[model samples]
Target: MSRSVAGPEIERLIQLMARLPGLGPRSARRAALHLIKKRETLLGPLSDAMRVAAERVVVCRSCGNVDTSDPCTICTDAKRDPSLIVVVEDVSDLWALERSGAVPGRYHVLGGVLSPLDGVRPEHLNIEGLVSRASEPGVGEIILALNATVDGQTTAHYVTERLSHLPLKITRLAHGVPVGGELDYLDEGTLSAAIRSRTAF
Candidate 1:
């Protein structure tokens, strides 16, 4: 059988930290020790922030974003292009796009992609909301910003089909060679995509 070196409170902290993505038992242990050592500077603030987030964070009803508001700042922003909607697989993707400042309009988070093997179906995602939003008169385009993985492509195709009936243009994030990337380091898919998506100089 295993043993407990610390009290239940400290051990519980380690267990909880281990649940975070990219954190395993050893990493969690190190993190827990760091937090404990810096309790006054890091742990207290983090705990308070978590408490506030738990209390106030809400899933936006219109776009499925997590924020302190229902519609979220993005959905309510008057400056955002109402004619375009960038569809992403998750809030993380939405944040990434926001950081890049490449998206020209509001966003619709699908919550997750369609992974039949993982039992994630259309009903499991926010596809119904997307279709409903796409039906609106002002929405003229939908840009699928999903990853290039098989599951991501599958989900994008499914979403395209769902929104096809609407009188709106649909686009996807272009796949190609990345800037400053060596040709030899890239895989076949990237090289092929770069050739297929070649643009004018």
Candidate 2:
């Protein structure tokens, strides 16, 4: 009998792994078999790692980033430009920008964009935190690096309206970003070019 068919425990494991991003039921079964075959090499270590991460991982208090520390490494970094802050819809977008090595300023992740159709609103995002950051002394610029989607544009316009009274310079990523595309899918060169050519929105 197959390991998964042998017990409820193994079956449950396969079911859960199947739910992961790219893994389907067949792949999950194959992965479970592979992990069982190399139990010491993969399964044991993976279980331990997941447990540790689940216990230790927490949101960065200041920026809402997933990290072991409170403020996150970026927020605590003294070398990063505190005068400027690039706002991203997700941490994945932040990672994409970092991979390009084009942005010198610090980042603030919005977690997600405003999509009323999907039940997401301004209150669902980190707009209040962003406004507070903008009001901070020595902060000069706020760059919106949201995806070039309808909801993204709506969120950007909303943020701009909220911060209009602030003296900080507000800017958005350039139009080079393809419509309906995500920053996480863009190449480093493309992301760098878009950021360099950024204009007010």
Best by TM-score: 1
Q: How well does model 2 score by local distance difference test?
A: 0.88
**Residue pairs in steric clash, candidate 2?**
none
lDDT of 1 by residue, 14-106 (tens): 999989999998899999999999999999999999999999999999999999998899999999899999999999999999999988799
TM-score for candidate 1 = 0.97
Query: Which residue pairs does candidate 1 place in steric collision?
Result: none
Where does candidate 1 have its weakest 10-residue lDDT segment?
Answer: 1-10
lDDT of 1 at 80: 89
Q: Estimate the TM-score for candidate 2.
A: 0.83
- Count of backbone collisions within predicted model 1: 0
Tens digits of per-residue lDDT for model 2 on 82-179? 89999999988988998999888888889899999999988999989999988999999999999878899899999999999999899987656787
TM-score of each: 0.97, 0.83
